[model samples]
Target: MNPPADADSPARQIDARIAALGDWRGETLARMRALVHEAGPEVIETVKWGGVPVWEHAGILCTGETYKAVVKLTFARGAALDDPTGLFNASLEGNTRRAIDIREGETPDADAFKALVRAAAALNASKRKPARR
Candidate 1:
C-alpha cells in the first residue's frame, strides 16, 4: 500500500518528506536543499518519482534521495562538470549522472557543494541559450 500524497506545493511536499524521515537523513536533505537554494535562488523545487526532491533551473540540477544508509544527491549532468573538491563519490560509472552519497555522521563540504550546484545550473542555462547564426 502507498501513503497519501503530501498537501499543496512542491516545497510543502518536500517539507513533509523531511519531517517524515525524522532522522539524520532528514537533516542532511534539508541542509543540502538549503545549499542548492543558496547557490541558485531561481531554482524551482519539485518532488519527482515518488517524493524525491529535485531542484531545477533551466533544467534538472540535482535530486535529493534519502536511503536507509545515505542521503544521495544525484546530478543529472554531473559528468560534464569539473570536481576539484572530489565531492562526487557515487554513481561514478555513469556517463551522464553523478552522485554524492552522504552517510550518517559524515559531513559534506558546503561551499564546494554549492559551487557544483551553481555549475549545474549554468550548464542547464547554456543549453537553453540560442544558437549563433
Candidate 2:
C-alpha cells in the first residue's frame, strides 16, 4: 500500500491541484483557501474524497469544490450558523450544509465570507469531543 501522506503533503497537493486547474476556477479556489486561513489560523488543510480541499478546525469548516462554471464553498455545519450577510445561495434545501456558489466574473464578499469561516470554526470547536483521560 502507498505510504500515508505527510502532514504537509495535503497543502502541497492542494497547491498542485490549483496549479493544474490553471484558470478562474483555480484562482477562485486559491482565494477562498487564503480567506479560510486568514479567518482561522489554526485551521487544518486536507485532501479528501478524491481531491477536494477541506479545511477543518476541531472539525470540518468547509470544502472547496471547482466546476466548469462555478467554484463552490460548502460549509460543514452551515445551517446552524447565522449568515446576516446572506452569503449562502446554494444548498439551502439541506438541513446541515449550506454553500456559496461563485460563478465566473462574480466576486464574493470577502469580509462576510471571512466572518462565515470564523463562525464555522467556532461552531466546530464548540462541538468537539472531550479528551479522554
Compose the digit string of candidate 2's lDDT tens values, residues 92-125: 9999999999998888999999999999988988
TM-score of each: 0.91, 0.93
Q: Per-residue lDDT tens digits of candidate 1, residues 1-133?
A: 1224656778888889999999999999989998988888898998899889999999899999999999999999999999999999999999999999999999899999999999999999998977789
Write down the worst ten-residue block by lDDT for model 1.
Answer: 1-10
Candidate 1 CA-lDDT value: 0.92
Model 1 ranges off by over 4 Å: 1-6, 129-133
lDDT values of the candidates?
0.92, 0.91
TM-score of 2: 0.93
lDDT of model 1, residue 92: 100
| Model 2 segments more than 4 A misplaced | 1-8
Give the RMSD in angstroms, all C-alphas superposed, for model 2: 4.1
RMSD of 1: 5.0
